[model samples]
Target: MPNRTDLEALPDIPMDDDGPVFREPWEAQAFAMTLELHQQGRFSWPEWARYLHQEIDKAKQSGDPDLGDTYYQHWLAALENICVDKKITSGEALAERKEAWDRAARSTPHGEPIELDRAIRRGEFDK
Candidate 1:
């Protein structure tokens, strides 16, 4: 688990006095995923920081505007990049999973949870 100092080292993390503040459930999930991967010794804090910085830099280069709302997007991208680089998962697998989630979200009713398994079972994604 990341300590206070480690979390604080992240750039523009939407934190309050208590800790990191997430405006959406997916953001919290992404944060938790990163922490869990770190705890598993998949990557060091410095490696995570470097990947995150690279993602942010790439987004800025593409004219992201640095509005802070996209911080977690960069964080998620960094996580994916690190996972791919570490051979934990391939880019193609990530893209497929992302497409599956998109299909699930599109098929789900408003205010209902989007579930990939449900979508798959419903033929939204091939098993």
Candidate 2:
């Protein structure tokens, strides 16, 4: 829901004539999710920018090249940080959900939609 002016204000983001440029589908999805959250008043653009900059800085400290390819990974990390900071979700809850999704994706047939199985629904991740 971010307009051109809003997107333009964020210098860290790479954009093209059509819009933001993403190397993968998840990158695009993360970008869209952040923009949608802003639109819904979850956070202001400046606040989002601050969190994103922090994530990028952390990655750089860890020897990331700040290359365009890893841009969205930082974006996703920032989004997660804000979600936790705002009390929308906890880190532990997110980890559990990620484990469930990983299990579902692993068992799903190629090209089929992934869904949680009985074990996942029952919070059974041991297997």
Candidate 3:
């Protein structure tokens, strides 16, 4: 995991004195996942930074405005890309999982947490 100095060196992270600030639950989740992956030695900090920069650049090329709101979207993209590149997970698996989550979210009532296991038990993942 990156130290405070390393994290501070990165550009445009929404942070407070308390550390990284997230506007939504999934943003924090993505941030935590990256930290855990790093701690597991899945990739070095430099490698993660490079992938994140690439994702940001790619988003810009596709006309994504340099708005603050999309920051975590880029972060998530970098995570997925790096995971696939490192063979930690395949693109197909990610896509399937994303679909499963979407189905779970749809089935969940408002204000309720979406659970993938429930979706699976409901045979939502049956192909």
Cα TM-score of candidate 3 = 0.83
Error of 3 at 73 (Å): 0.5
10 residues in a row with least lDDT, candidate 1: 118-127
Off by over 4 Å in 2: 122-127
Residue pairs whose backbone atoms clash in candidate 2: none
Q: Between candidates 1 and 3, name the one with more favorable TM-score.
A: 3
Report clashes for each candidate as comma-separated counts: 0, 0, 0
Q: Write the per-residue lDDT of candidate 3 for residues 1-127, one digit (tens) a residue.
A: 5778878766577889978889999999999999999999999888888899898899999999978799999999999999999999889878888888888799899999878875475674455
Per-residue CA lDDT of candidate 2, range 35-84, in tens? Answer: 88888898999899889889999999999988777888889999999999
Model 1, TM vs. native: 0.82
Per-residue error for 106 in candidate 1, Å, reads 3.7
Model 3: how far residue 48 lies from native, Å: 0.2
lDDT, candidate 1, 41-61, per-residue tens: 999998899999999999999
By lDDT rank, best first, the candidates go 1, 3, 2
lDDT of each: 0.87, 0.85, 0.86
Q: How many backbone clashes does candidate 3 have?
A: 0
Q: Which ten residues in a row have the lowest lDDT in candidate 3?
A: 118-127
Question: On lDDT, who's better, 1 or 3?
Answer: 1
